[model samples]
Target: MISSDFDSDGFVDIAGLDSTGRYLLVYFGKGANQFHGLTRYWLITKSDKIYSADLFKKFIPNLISLNKLSGKIEIYSFVNRKLNRNLDISVGYYPENLMFDDFTNSRTKEIICYGKNFGGISLITFQNEDYKIQKIDSENTYANVTPIFLNSDEYLDLAGISLKDQELHIFTNRNLRFSKSTIKKFTDRIAHLASSDFNDDNFKDICLISNSTNELIILYGNGLGGFPTAASFDLQYNADEIIIQDFTKDNLTDILFLDNASKNIFIKILKENHEWNSSIPLTKFNNLISFCLYRTRSQIGILCSEAFERNIFSIVNSSLALEKNIFTLSSNPTSIEVLKNTDEVINEICWIDKLDNNFCILKRNEFNTPERIYRFKLLRQFDSYVINKTLENQLDIVFFSLGKNYFDFVNFNLSDQSISRKTLTIYGAIDKILFFPTDHDTPNVAALNQRGNSNYITVTNPFKINPIIIDEPLVSSSVSNYFFDSVERILFYMQPHQVDTIIEFKSKKFNPTYSQGETKNHFRAEIKKGSQVITHAMDLGDTKKFDILNFFSSKGDGYLLTSFYQTDGYLPDSKEDEIILHDKSKIKAVKNDFSKTNEFYIYNENSQSVESLLSLKKGKRILTKKIKEDKEIREFTINLLPRERRELIYLRNNSPFIYLENF
Candidate 1:
């Protein structure tokens, strides 16, 4: 329901649209505090407006109506005894609300229409006395918008709240331009906003009703048009709508809220100092929307529309609580969706009155009961769905063979909590099923339908009713194809193969440079593959990376050769010319002295393949390696983690270490 002086009279008039009937009714106010009605059999606009107060700069009083036929807004101005054509407002599909306010705080009101589905605000402010429609930067989806004075100035800013992300967006005013807004995220969804002077500060404070938490958050406004951080208070009751009124007449504002607890109207009385008190009276009604009315000079009553009917609750004496049993609903209501398209515009609450059988629009008849106008059905089930999937993500698409090979894909709608089914054609008891995604704009699933008795991979989908079959090695992990090629079930299907593992031995606490025992047989494990014990090989080493080598021979002579990768570190620095092994007698002495000490041995883990170790003793350190000095011999040893091979040499008297270059 909405109110404006429809006949341009001094008294305020009421207008309501019966959701079931789709007719617009204008309650033209008669002078003596009364109204005579005029009805038009038409679809009520999604957002309604009546400029009873000169809203537009044109000073033209207009009545806004959404043409249900064209989905266009038709504004009518009161000329004679009735309303005539004045103007029409347009936005994309479903303009949520229309309001006339000084959005720029420029002392002039402009016609503003907010777009809900198309996602922007139609700010119809004036430029040089001509209507200029400008839009603010907005998201593709938003909840509601309001012009608020938030800063310490007279400029009007915007606050657009979105339930999608639970954020309150603040759009600062920038004179002739629209400034981008900032968002403050909240934990709870803000359902509605009502302004009142809750504290004694005398500034209009903002109260937002939480849809989920059932709490009313009050943001106290400073006198300089700014508000501090908000504070929350539990309402002790879940409310979908709240209206401020001075029911106690104590100058403290009291709230009349629609409590979902008992589907009722509950009055919360305020103290003399504007504080909410607990304990409110409960009255039940399936009210879609309600407006408070003064019954007599002293008695306050409430007018409520409960989908199919209306109710009037007279305020009890002294208590200010509304009494039940003035009226009731004629049918059961499903749910209500609130669309705010106005600045302080209390408009109609579109209702779904009938649930069963033929649906119709309705309003009050002669006996104040809902009268049906026409009948039609509104859709209940969600028609289309999207099966969006990324190949990396795992979503279950199990096909249960319903006793008789009647297959169905699980079709569940989480929004309405309903279960439905889509047919899948698969026969002859499938043993394995795998779902894989194909490259497509929409999600496409490729299923591997393997039969219990066959050796083929069958893929099924909506378009391809007959399964696509591929014949490949059934014992393989996956079918070898241009697409997906691997599965544990196929790779391990009753077949076993021997794996040759080269187990390089590593010391536990023993040092790699000075270990006593050989590691070739120290650590060993046997692998049994289908009754065959697979023999493994182990390499023993005393160092991670081998470099320099020097040995004193048995003849008191020196023999030396070093790896090419790095410089020889153990040798003394500076003297390039020394009494070294190059001399024939010293080379023979060193080769003879260290011949026995320069040799090491190794036994394999299997007690087989006896590999030798390289003996290169520098000072007291001796590194064990499997390298042999013979040209035809294998490497003495290898290192683990990063494996490196090394070889050793023994010098005889004929071809001795007289001059060794690279080893």
Candidate 2:
């Protein structure tokens, strides 16, 4: 059976050979589970199977039929419910099966088939308006052949099972010719062969079922035309057919088989340790010739074709529950449905080929899960997601709050003057939030919000009392904005405002405790002039006297002298260039240090005076003084310089501080 949009009407149509193999049955799809009546075309009486291809690369697809007895292949162009013979070629060997694949990566479908009775494999390709056949000789006749990507190459290789020799052969494609790459002899005769990325290693692996030993042998490919790993599992039943796919949707390739005796379907999922889980048996299927997997809106299902009935099975919770028969064909019906079930149910198109020049299409409207548990595991729910440790061993799950257009704003009361308030109404819903832990009680949060299809992210002062809003908009949901590296505490997100795209944010371990006070003794130190220890009182309008210190007679080096009045300790021989004092509060810097630069000044401001009460020049050093205080405020740093004008700044008592620097 073959399916395509034959009329280019966006609906799938089907065509197949009748029981006698002489007549071609085509049915046009009318959609909504209906098909047009029989459109029959007389062809060679001994035709075996029918295949369809888009030979002209147009929307309309054409049909190809193979005659094994006559060793002839014919291509028919189906237009307006009519068949026109376009080409006929005599392919010498009696090819049993046909596979259409782009062997050369040329984007054109090439016909590949293996001949019967020691006849080698042949490749039929169209070139220069003629069908060309390239036969590759084989020492052992293959029972079945299929094209597989044995290596990470552009061309497709061939894998065949030789039942007579009890061997599996892999032929590598090189310059449109196949060369024997690997031929492994098996102790038991292989029944079926299937290939997939079973280990999720990006390399395609091969799985074969041994009919005699009832064992499923797996040859793990190395992506270099070699199987470095091999394993076998006992089926415990005579397995006739095999398929490898992600049946459970767990991103793991599972093994499925049809029992030869009872014709029941058995499946086993591959675990991460390369071990098979417990084997599960689905409901029995009678006279099952071949089966394929189909997907519905909610779950994945199976479609099996038998002698007289086409059975549809839904996989629910790991069990295959048989659905009601979708089609009951005549005694000698040759029905065909769209075998590619990758699309949704509404897109499915099916047609059955009745032997007596009759064809019918099935309208599948019902589905049921099996009595056993077959589950569909959900891998993700959001457009994207990320996990971060907001607290120690605690997770603050933040994802795209879908359909939510608002967020709750909460503010914690830190003093008696401020009351705790929660506001439920806030516009521009938060699409995503990222928590960046810092050395404080509060974390640096990066928030994302959307307004009128425009996304904006706050990199600084995010989720604060008055959150700082950046003017520029961020990338949309379709583009990747940031890459958060939890291991290295780095976030590489999109920052369009950066000149060099400096989007990396390296974080530190979150510290939630405030800075504690120390019990160290406090002393007063003065920067004296002319190498003489003389403390000059800092009063209002002392700038004229302070400027005269630069005219010292010797131009002598200045020194900082420490004096302790309570204990009578004096630093007479000390040559300390800078004096540092730490009050009960955290003061980051006082004078010019590496944090600022060399040759900077500090001005002591008094509320009563227009000019600074005292201004002193400090060279290449920072000083911290202990001026005991009781208020808890965020640590802040102030930058001041000399010969440069300074601005008047006011700080309210017991309020949080903002860092200010005058460069």
Candidate 3:
């Protein structure tokens, strides 16, 4: 039996095999104990083994059956209340068991079959319409094989038991190929094998049940494709099946085994000291055929299946003695989705037997309370939706994309229990909707638009009635994108495929630390259309690009700002301001204060002429600032220190420049 959310509605559904009748029975789960839609489909007969997998990654797990008579794998998908065979591949021979795992990490599972008559394992993988089959370990016979990660490398390896050789086979996967590494001298017959990282280490550890001695063996992996250490625990009953998982939610792996004699499930919890606790009975039913881990988003339970019904039990006081509920079935199940509810606080659960069909909703957790069960025909699911508290009154506004060119805006009022929806048609296909917070009561929205083969930008306040859309197309157009700074009422835009050219604008922010009660912060963006473009070039001699950091302008004249670097040399006390350095020595930095603007240069090449030269004085740093708006003579802030470098700053004119007061 296999369990999956066949309708993609989060609740678990069951797909069971009726091999005797050659039919696949499906029961879509409505809730914990509620089910409906007992539908059946003709597939394979009693000799076929059924397994459920999402081979297409399409959210719905399809039923796969390996037919021994036909020697073919058939996949049946549940669609529109009918099970349809989607894929059929011939394997030439039937194997005893099939394992589904993504050995190639390709998101789709590959079929690994073992216990064949030819004494080997075969791999079947599907890519598009083509399928590839490979045979591995054709020499040895494996009773059963499981996927494992034996080494530190993150690849799936094969772990199997060979009853004839009385040995455990570990096939390490290297570059997608498996090579057998044997572990011999297993005195007892190994019945079941499972692997997990029991000690919280990244290495995979193995635990097997020996039916002959009725002992459980533990093999600790050293993470180098070896299980050198072994431990054994005496079991009360013979277990034929083993499951290794973290059932206790403690991050450490635990072992659960089903006793073959009494048909009872038991779990051995792992402790912090890398030891196993005594086996605790986990089943409340008798004559159970099989069991599995039943999990949902909110709870984990153990599901035990019998001939007529399935019982789900949860851990209450660390035991499954208190059975939750038993769900009866008309026929035995082959596969069932236990539960896949994802909501944290589940008020109601909904499910459908077929995709896009009528579904049933059931209220949960109130067993004695009479609740209404509703059956509704499925409506169209929205393409995309986003909710935000964007209004001043703090109500949630949900934006749902109905289609490419239409959007439905929903405003929900919890106090009044009312909802208002309005549809808006956009100029082009809406790629994305971005909401920018504004100081006003209504939030501003920007929608990225794509019409035909070209992209554009549409800016508007979507909350306003008869909202104006400022659509700027970028196709041989000057504007590629635009952003509206609502506070300044300035629209900044960029040209098509332009990245290098930029515009820097500063806004005055209130700050008591400055001379005035405010300071100006420099904000930059790509230059918009109809903006002035400035071009200038300079060569600072022997100065690295990182030495010069920021550039700011005040009233059209640009000032290149930087911090001075210290040289690596010895200094004399008599001439402390000067240092002698080696010619090939590296310049040592004093302190990297990225905001320490200690040096500045008057390098406004656009305002003045180009290709003019200036020299840097040794052991001195300069800072230039305009003292008054009308004054042309720049004020200088100078500090003398030992720094080894002379730079040639480019001036606009070809004339000799000299320092008046400081030199």
Candidate 4:
């Protein structure tokens, strides 16, 4: 079935087609200012890869045959396309709320029609281009609402009692004979019915609204033919309409009821034990037209209307919270959908409305802030609009109007607290808005206005493009660690090893000298690059030279040595000069060929080694013969200054050991 904002009218008209792809629409409207009552019909057919239709000459005559002259009834086909003239049947009464029943071998279409002559109920069947009507033999004569077909043979008829009280009449078709039975009766009006497995019993449970007492009735049975046991609860609000489905994923049934008395809607959840638990208020509005509940795996869409405006809201399970202010429309919302298994996480919400003399496009975001709302207006009169969501998350909105004309699709982004103001003018009347998936192509918008009685003025075409992208820069390059000084200056890009060194050096020396220190005992140190330093040092006894021998050693031919020296001479003569010294030696240039001589000696024997002594003689060469002895050659070089002494050592194998006496 497809609905259209025909003639850019605020109301959406419904159309249906049979399996053979034929159109059957009723109660058609002409334009924005013309509603042809509930008597017009149009036949649509597919030709040359397009769905085309014309005014069927027999529609008005058939409508007159189905109504009671004084009372009016609108025909609504439950199928998607139109009715096939070859299979069309002339049956008794006008069909309202028509649906198909295919549970049996043959496809049977069921409809509810009421007239003064045909008071009780009637069923029609079409086969071999012939129509047959079967009057349901019942004792009660009242206006029958619609008959709901369950499975193929069983059906439920909601008959009204004097346009006030409602009752459920169950009918079963067996051996081509119809049997009618009154299952449940109430003192209220029956609004709607939904069937689902509510108690995990594998049976279809029926949920219907009793408007007389504002209560919801749940009837459970094994099958449509089995006896049904029912329970009723006072809904506490006047239910103008109600829809039932499995919304909470608990394998139980839930309901959404529209309360016109309070202008509020309520959701009732049926527990696993067949008990109606809590009811929560959904939304409040005035003059609610209709509501639809489209269920997905995760969420449920509540599509409703207040006055002429339509709104769509979603209910999330995690917090049991309802996301509000989703989308609002100036025209009536025709259809709503909660999509499943799309690439996007948020399901798409699409609706059609009328704006001025054109039709407006209404859509909701399905990913990220999936609740972001958008609206657009189109030109030309249409019969139906379809909104399709493809695998790529692209939306296609298509409209079927009487004739093709240029349309200006204007979209707007509104603030959360701001109302949208219509700024564009459309010249042509719009009919319907249809959405379909485009093959990687965006839709285009056009504007056309009436130039004269038969001609129209066209405007420049405008293409709708996706919004812009914004770029943001990172604050810093460092990822793991950060630090700050006393003055609140932040430092990033710190290494792990440097952090250990800073912590160790600070813990060892209490009174360290710093480059910016102003106190006598305290000093400041600033680490700019390689390593940390001790800003101040405590006085450890008189100046002393301490030698700590190697306690542990490895065999890599590399050695590390650490020496400690204490000085008490009123600091150094120059801060740049060495503060502590053990031995002093001056290096001198050698005049002889030191490379040919194997034996070399030094006064400071502590540093006498072949490698050290030869290095002191600048530009000197050294050579050695093939010596097998472990203790062969050892040399050293010594230098003596006025206030300092130095020594260097060189050794070959485990060469000769040197000892020094107190200087």
Error of 1 at 605 (Å): 97
Root-mean-square deviation per candidate: 33.7, 29.6, 27.6, 35.9
Tens digits of per-residue lDDT for model 3, 161-269: 8756767888877756878878756877788888888667788888788888888788888888888888888777777677677665557777777886776666677
Error of 1 at 12 (Å): 2.6
The CA lDDT at 571 in model 2 is 24
What's each prediction's clash count? 27, 20, 11, 60
lDDT of each: 0.42, 0.48, 0.51, 0.35
Candidate 1 deviant stretches above 4 angstroms: 20-22, 31-33, 37-53, 57-61, 67-71, 104-108, 115-118, 126-130, 180-183, 223-226, 245-249, 269-274, 279-283, 286-302, 310-663
lDDT of 4 by residue, 130-224 (tens): 55566764355454343334443443433233332355666565634656666666665665555666677766566666566667776776664
Cα lDDT tens digits, model 2, 1-663, are 555666767665656666688887766766532468768779954688777777656546778788887777787776666678888877766777777777776646788776555377778887667777887655667777767788767888889877567677888988687788546888767777878877778998888887788787889989988898899887788767666666655577887777868767777767767788656565466776546554333334454555566332323221122222221122122212221221222111222222233222222232212111111111233222223333332222222344454332222221222222222222455555555556655444455555675555443333466654332344333222333322233222322222332122111221122112112222332333322322221111212111111100112332232221212222233224333112212212122322232221222121111112122333312232322122322232232323352212222122111111122
For 9-56, candidate 1 gives per-residue lDDT tens digits of 565555666554345666565533345655553543443422343655
**How does candidate 1 score on lDDT?**
0.42
Model 3, which residues run further than 4 Å from truth? 19-21, 31-33, 44-47, 116-118, 308-364, 368-663
